[model samples]
Target: MKKYKDFVCVGFAFALSTVSCEAKNDAKIHVSQLGYTPNSDKKAMVVPDGKVDSFYLCDAASGKICYRGKLSPKKYWDLSGEDLQWADFSSYDKSGEYYLSVGGKKSYNFTISSKAYDDLTLWAHKTFYLWRCGIDCTEEFSNFHGQSYAHKAGHPDVNVIVHPSAESAGRKAGSTVKSPGGWYDAGDYGKYTVNSAIALESMLMSAEAFPSFYKNFDMEIPESTNNTVDVLDEAMYNLEWMLTLIDTVDGCVAHKVTTKRFVPMVLPAETNVQRYMIGKSTATNYGFAAIMAKASRLYKNNPDYPDFSEKAMRYAKRAYEWAEKNPGIIFHNPDSIGTGSYTARFPEQFRFWADVELYLATKDKKYIDLTAIDTFQYDVPTWQLPASFALMSLIVGVENNMVDGDLKKKTELHFDKLANLLYDRMEKDPGRFPLFKFEWGSNGGLANAGTILLLQYKKTGDKKYLKAAQDITTYMIGRNATGYCFVTGFGQKSPMFIHDRRSTGDGIAVPVPGLLAGGPTLDAIRDCDTYVYNYDHPKSEYPTREYPARAYNDEICSYSTNEVAINWSAPFLMLLAGINENSK
Candidate 1:
């Protein structure tokens, strides 16, 4: 049977080779434009229009075939209607520039090295600094990006008015509060506490998990000389902004700070509108407590901010107490408002995370009792479902024996189940990533899935988990259905037109570097009238909107598909950091 199959494949290749001359100059081959690590599993996806039973890995400078490998059996996927085969070259370990060649098509040049992703990781990390709000330090940015990337400090937000929905006896509707400084939540200029909570935790947790990787990591920010690591320093910019959302009189937290409606597509400083401190909610309060507790623990002994740990913990406890008193208060946008609504209808997930972080910070059994880990769902986390933060943190604590023995066993079991599910998904999918259903912000889901697999690899030292995570990296960089690298400013074919207001209005040819565009989604067609269905291809040959993986439109108006968000960027940064730290 094996010999017969080989004969059939050879015959197919022979018949397909005759028409290979008719192929277009641009072929349907997908590879990681950024390259791969030397010792990792490396494969490229081929569409195989005709004549491709094998592939050659040739040295880019010498034009010599370093390795030749067979293509896997043809497979079909619903994500895109393309028949695909894998070119396995895991045995090639040379460290140099190379390209893949099939019957008549050649891929873009890629590299293999121990430090393949170092520059990507650094550039992506610096995006957080560039996204900083209410700060005027474009000189530092200009120096780093090698050009003038300047914008006036926007949304100072010193005297923000309290809205009717958030009014209390202590802080009335007509009153004002000083709420300033935070990364914009998305393409819009709103600052949402609920969304910022998950974003902040992703950064702080990444720093905690890989302390040595971040030590002395110079991000070229103004705070690089502050004696603290740059990740923590960048996080502090948002942390101080979050601190202003807490109502000191009664410990209630505002849900968001935003203008009544989205401002026009202009630079941050050009939007002249009154910003309001919006509704109060149990969800936002719990989110604030969780982040503050985690921050308190991560910065406990740092020399630069001697009092931050204590002060953060104090506010955390107060916010936690307030949420405990008002457990049923959920947030909804008022009838008059039309900005982004990060509504959290159920507060239990936030409560679970806050309990875990507070327990870790204080070693209090009371907080532990409130966290019902046995009943908690171990879904891969998003801003909407955040119990994964508690699960990941608990596993870290268990490794250090900081928690009880029984709790450790339960966490191990939960994490192991999640890891196995992710591995199975990757093994089954032709794209080699766990993302199949292209919901809004599907690329963010890809990043979170990669993060979990990397963490599992770290905990168990399993090469399978590492390989799965690396495959996800390939998908994001270029090896996928759309044939476009989803990250801006880093690939041969990347998103040049992302749905970011500042990037659109900044008068720059290039969008901000390192921002991950929310990749393809069929759902965007219904939401956006300006989404183009195809790019530089006949509609019959490449139907972008019909397939989930190819549904992306790189238009500035396609917010559902092309927008960049803080929560999405956070886990993506974590995923990139993990790849650089572990792939070596």
Candidate 2:
């Protein structure tokens, strides 16, 4: 009899459970016969417990699973202590795995077979479909004019659900209204989040999220997922949408529907020319920079702008240079390191994509140097500082022979390690990763998304890439489930809830109302059924009006705007489309 010591540790996604211990200290363990239970034992490796049913004895290190007699048991052996071969671990390792914890039951499904690749492609397409236009297949109706107009039905900006008081720092929904009713129809701005940017980003990133974007010689790579791919292909789709608003000098975005001959150069979310949603477009234009570079690289094949690459690079370079030059305003000044709080600070941080975009556009070392792989003065792991950028640098560095084999391996490991290190914070913290109060939703999905993209982009290992997106998406959707219905919906203690931006002029008031669930709130509800104290506090009674939800929250709003209802239920509608579709 061999007994393993009781090891205690958390497994993936912080699923806490107990493992069994079987002790046989003096047994001579021979390496040659290192199969699971080489002994011809008849008795089952049973550990009687309160609710114990079946068990398996196996070699811990080699993953050689064995039953009492010969082969592994047909019954799924609930192995403990992270034994890779506890039950169908090989299958789990081989295929695309999905193990979502529902009602505390750890059920898993996988995609396998030689056609496993095809299956994954199909699965990917299905998911893409789900998110592309949601379950309603509303893609055709989701024209730019629809949502931007707000008054129109089938608006793409459907997720904009905000608290009654959150519109003007808990003041009023609009500048004039003393009460909450009549926003979209009243022609009174019903404040929104920066939905246009994300919508555009989604379109661009979608195109290049898969390996098919790059031409592969050895393997017959699949083609793009068509329109679904374009939805996320931040490179082209997002770029084109972005071009629609680039007449601005520095830059201006479109927050609402406008039929005007000429739109003003202002933050799209915050503009006065349009009598649409009154969203704040000011402060921290820097946040969108990272994704801008990412989209630029992903869609390098086609740039809508004349020398789009150069313009993007120029924008990023000029922006940073300006930030650095305006040190006192952007950074520390009177306080010494002085930026006590990130409330108003617009961090001009760079990621690997930033430098790569510049390099891909112009092979200049000067641009390469701008890729800060070193820590910033006010360094912290959460900021992702230079580490996040390092992931991109690894590929560029290897290509440029900047680092040797061993060094490359180290860089690869460090890149992964840093991501893990950041994820560790989120895992340990119970909910969100360590974030700057002023940072808001920026750090929410970034670490996970960054980690996933980093690993996926570095190595064409679809598992890392897919897993990253799925997990983050799960977190996003889960928030909606018990909360708004998407696991990662709005960050609310209750389903009928909203967040207030406390730090600077910027806050959840900006993102929350704008119909985008965003990275932060999605992360908080990724796992649990409710918010931190949701159990204690009863759910807000359906709100005089409530947010849209996934399979849940089918109830129509008596007062809620169509966009808010859409944002509320979009993620849920999107995630469930597969189960509903595949079942059919």
Candidate 3:
């Protein structure tokens, strides 16, 4: 079997002649990428086309062999479309620069260090500060990619045109409301209730899971100097904005606060378009309820803002009542609106999550009775569908002995099944990538899957689960197809031209640091013109050679492939946090 693995040069490559070969065989080996963590499970791909059964890891400094390893065959993958093998270097635990050699071929230089993901983790958390809406990004705050007067002057959000999908007796075309202060949804400037719920909850969960790690952590945002913890302060900023979205009269939350169409690529302050409270739905209300309930618990009796918890509880109760009365209401973007729809086909999950949060916060038996855990799906968390968020919250509740006996058993059983399934899939995978499906923001799925595996490892004390989780992170920095580091401003060959409006329009040399590009998507929905090869074919048609995993282009126009999103960046941040804390 002749196996071919994808390999791209990272800036420069070492001279092949520099590595002296002891074996006389003509076969050679290849590696997926050029980096690995010292404490994580480390492995390099061995191209199956070669007859090299074994290879030696040599120290880069002295050219002395550190450890020799036999190659193990892995299952064939559709991405490579060929059988490949992996050289397990998990047993090698020394921190140094090293390379693998087979016959005359030498793999790229890789570093094994404890601080591998430290800088990236810090930058990932700071990305939220950059994404903060309705704030002036001063030079001191923004550093290199500074832009002043950025969305600082927000409107009163009165006299807005309410879409027909959201039209009610009280909310007419010329309705008056107040909504401000939330992070932009994605590459575009939009604040959505559903998306904000996921982003905020994920960060809060990160804080909960790793309290000691985040205790002294400073995001360097405007609120960093405050007496409150920086993560809580940041979440509070969005929580405040979310609170204003809910109508005090009916407890209905607007779907989004956005313009009729996406503004041109320019500085935030340059664009002066009127933003509107677009629509309201049960999904939005339920999401708002869940987030506020969670916030109520996080902010209760805190050093800063002692009254925030009571206010949040009141808002949460109001939203929950609204959801109870107006269940199953879905919001479709009105015909006139050209912004993101953010439509939720299934609002039941949102309701369940809300019930769980409210139950945990208030310890009210009524909130617990409304939950339907049997229908909940335990998978990696995402913004669009957030059953996993509720599941994770319940798991944490059980660990803290906050959940009752019945609920705790159900949560544990669900987690055990999910962990077993994930472990089995990883064990059978040829590439060892957690997610089998490659879609928009697939890297986020990879990271979230790693988070789940890490949780399982923490619970079961199984080294295999921990190793699998580490493998996923290793794949992100540099590994597998495409060979580009999905994150900007790190690694030798990372995304230079991401589909970000600020980075594209800003006159800066590089895009904002710590932004994770939506990795390869099988469906490149937007910006088809940039992919000239698919001109004659259908809009959805891509070349046969363009493997799903390899179908990525680091161009400004490839929005489907190269776009940076908050939902995608959130899990990556959590994964980095897990790795950082666990490595310690």
Q: Which model scores highest in TM-score?
A: 1
For residues 1-584, could you state the per-residue lDDT of candidate 3 as single tens digits? 22223221122254332444343322224342435666677876655554657667777766666666677745577775656677777766777777777655676667778876767888888877878776676656666335332233333344445655555556766655556677887778888888888888877877777777787887777888878878788788788888777667777777888888888766576676888788888888888999899989988888787888998889988888888899888888888898888888778888888989999998887876524787866777676678878878888787677887788888888888777777787777776656657767888788788878877776777878888878787677766655567888777568887767677666665777889898877776446575332112134433333567667777766777888888788878887887777875
For candidate 2, the lDDT comes to 0.29
C-alpha TM-score for every candidate: 0.92, 0.42, 0.87
Can you write out model 2's per-residue Cα lDDT over 114-203, one digit (the tens) per residue?
A: 332222222222222222210232334222223221111222332223222223333233333111111121111222222322322323
User: Cα lDDT for residue 318, model 3?
Assistant: 88
Please rank every candidate by lDDT, starting with the best.
Answer: 1, 3, 2
In model 1, state the lDDT of residue 132.
74
Candidate 2 error regions (>4 Å): 1-50, 53-209, 213-237, 240-298, 301-307, 310-321, 328-357, 376-413, 419-584
Tell me the spans in candidate 1 whose CA falls farther than 4 Å from its real position: 1-27, 143-145, 530-543
**How high is the CA lDDT of each candidate model?**
0.81, 0.29, 0.73
Top candidate (lDDT): 1
Mind sharing the TM-score for model 2?
0.42
TM-score of 3: 0.87
Where is model 1 poorest over a 10-residue stretch in terms of lDDT? 1-10
